[model samples]
Target: MKKPFNSKLFFFILATLFGVILSLPTFLQTQGPKIILGLDLQGGLNLLLGVKSEEAIKVRYATLASALNHYSIEEQILLDKLVVGEDNLSFELLDSNEKSKIDKYLSQQEGLEIVEKDLQYTLALSANEKINLENFAIEQAIGNIRNRLDQFGLSEPSVIKQGSDTILVQLPGIKTQEEEQRALDLISKGGHLQMMAVDEARNARVATMSEREAQSYGDVILPFINNPQQTILLKAIPILDGSMLTDARAAYDNNGQPIINFTLNSQGGKIFADFSGKNVGNRMAVVLDGKVYSAPVIRERIGGGSGQISGGFSVSEASDIAIALRSGALPAPIFLLEKRSVGPSLGADSIRASLIALISGAVLVILFMVFYYGIAGVIANLAMVVNILLVVAVMALFGATLTLPGMAGIILTVGMAVDANVIINERIREGFRAGENFIKSMENGYMNASRAIFDSNLTSLIAAVLLYVFGTGAIKGFAITMSIGIIASVITAIVGTHGIFRFLQNSIMKSGNYALWFGYKQQVYKRKL
Candidate 1:
């Protein structure tokens, strides 16, 4: 016969496990951990931009249009014929009949610099420049896509350019799907970003509407420069325009006021400088669509020729404005390509399936423990409950999103968590039958089990870590949940199970209740009568 194991140890282990588990939520959620949110769990928006080849071709022709216009070249007179083909632009000189007139006209265009080679007049457009313009437009489209996403107020959005003509946008955790889609749809429209005169009456500028009215507009669009007279409304055209801006930045003036600084490309610079020189002291408005972004008073001939638009802005706001300008406005109207919604019913189904899997797994394990080890199996079952409670608490504290894959990890941990306890309990029972005292048997059991426990767990942990490193999205979620659960299980098994047994040992000593606990007496083991 064997003395029953100590109840004091069991209670202590139970208390310690429960206490730690209960406190985990507090520890993890103290400052709100970086918990992952799924696209469905956090209803947000997704935008896929299909860049039309036609749009790019149209833009190319538009650039050619501007070039022709700049030289005062009559489209019909100088250009013999214009043929806008699908993938190429072809034009013949009107006076192929007059070689002298064509030569003289080509001489006046500064950068166009056409040269006659092998009897064919070829415009010397730099290959690099053409490539750069194409790349720049694509980049600008990317920028516009980003701005549109920002307007939706989604935190940590994923927006990137996919090819020369495609953009992919994923905004997780957005509040309204419709609003997010609406904002993104507006992006491909590429609303105009222009400089226009501020229409005082039409402008949403008033000294002091009621505080409520003021609040309604969320912060009135303030002027970049304090001037009432010159307000140009910068805007975007329905057709693709304004590829002229080469660079833009944020800086401070001589008085140290925040300002948006911009310079057009050489061709655009020529036009801007000329415009500034002619419109000196007039009000030039920077407009986007129909809204006034900045209205600056043209002080002097701005030929040298970069100009600044100063406004009352914090550093962040100014940087955003600068980025918006550099990125260029959106182009071509956009339509919603796709829309999706994940109802709560699906989420409920996920939760239900997860719970069923976990419970089914746990129940089978508990049944096996009881059938195999009898009384010791009961203790292990109780410990399993404690383990699960702790895992839940830790998850709540960490604010971890419980995805279906994460649920699988939790259930897997439940099975593995009790393996160490099973090893040690079986070892101790065998030691008792082999003529060892309680303390000796218990010490030997844990000491011998440590290596096997450690070896198995370390291997599991390594696998979990590797999964976490390589996996993305849902796979990563599983890895994280498994890793955390495994760690918690090891801790609870070693320290937690030890505490439970220790309390049991102490209780047996105090109450002389070993027989009741283990279902055997010391006398019954003797003399084999």
Candidate 2:
């Protein structure tokens, strides 16, 4: 005769499975699985950008100012006021003299039609023009941020413009996190490089060259400022600049020193080759954000078009520089105003809190189960452990990022998953009270509970799906995890619990241990009317 299955023994095996599956993330993460880290888990910078609509309007008005100057009709024109209506920008230009000619010239510009009456000429944009301008500025801003983040070597950073002007950047995992903000600042600077004549004789006079001579001999490159002193000659006119670079990596030079290797696209290659060939023996500067990073004297033409920039750099620094250069520069400067790092102390607190919550909740559930149905509750609790194991295995399989909210979802799911088994077990207890045999009652309980279990979990699964569809990062994470748990609960409750129960039933029948399988020692409490 087969011996009845021990509930304690079942729980031990289930626990082992749970432990193995839960450990998968740690093992995979240790092996560098490239899992996405949240901002809280990995320290990084957060930048809040406020788009200057007035500033954009000022630039547009400045263009008008320039156009007025170009036409040689300058009468100390003052943009008396810029009234920003809901649809367009209305500028009140007040200039007593040359007002008629200036108004005529401005009206000639297609989108910038003007209304000239007396001394005040109201210059306003059409509805479509205003919308187009706003869209173009926003697109430019977004592209700039994208380029900056790319240069900073942030992998898959999130850059979304919230309203008309606010940009939300969420970079989950970034090395040297400070570099993120620094790169943003540099890109915004809009620096450039320039070429200048070198005051030096041939090789014979090299030893006598002054500091100023050496600096000029290389290239008089300077940062691009609102008012710059000089303009350096570009090696290439950037036929296709940062937009064309497919990939960039850092490697060692022949001397085993750090260098950045970059590859340009087909069009970029041709432009680079043509420029390099034409500019042999001339010095060209590699400018980024208006600053000259390196100025190499061209010896020969490079046409096949892949090149390396070798500066005296450490390995880590070389890699970082290469990453930043490859990613396009930012359009506007961004400052890191706020930073908060997640310390190990906070992580420890979270872990302890989670443990306490899990233990307390599990104890309550176990007590409720035991008091309600005695031995049957113990079996269901054993199944709950397996449910958790299945959830973890699924998590490992999908590789979902787990947040604190997701952990809460997991803990909450533990109780909910067991509720399914509890319902089925209680139904079996009722069948036993109705004078059915152990095996018959078990089958009846499962069959009756199957519909309720499926319907209940299915409804929750739908809600989870909807939440995932509409929710943002963290909430979506919670919904996804809860959904997985619900699905796992259904399978473990219906299949796992039934399988264990059936296995125990068969053993009890063979070994004459019916009381052990059915919890016949427990009595049902009747309600007093």
- The top-ranked prediction according to TM-score is 2
In order of appearance, the predictions have TM-scores of: 0.52, 0.65
Per-residue lDDT for 1-529 in model 2, tens only?
Answer: 2244655346545654764656566546654223344454454444556554434454454345434432342344565433433333344556566566656666687666566566555566766766666666666666756765666656555566666666666665544656655555533443211122222233235445443543443312243322243334331122234444566688998899887787777765765666567667865555544454565777887777576665576786666556555554333334443344345455456656876887788788888776665566787776666666666666665555665676687788879978898789778768767767667777799899989999999999999999989876667767977998897777667776776766566654454443444454635422111
Best by lDDT: 2
Model 1 lDDT tens row, 1-529: 3244455355545655664655554446544334444454454555666654335434554355445434433333455323333343344554656566656766664435355643345454445545555666666667676765565355545566655566666666655656554554445545444444333443444443443443233222333333543333221111113566766677887877777787766766666666666667666666444444555677876665455556565665455556656666554334444545545456567767777888999999988877666555677777777766666666665656556677788898889878888888767766666766666666788888878888988898899999978765466668877887777666667666766666566554455333343333342211111
Per-residue error (Å), model 1, residue 300: 9.3
Off by over 4 Å in 2: 1-164, 167-221, 224-239, 281-283, 310-314, 325-337, 397-399, 509-521, 524-529
Q: Model-by-model lDDT, in order?
A: 0.58, 0.59
Q: Model 2 residue 98 lDDT?
A: 57
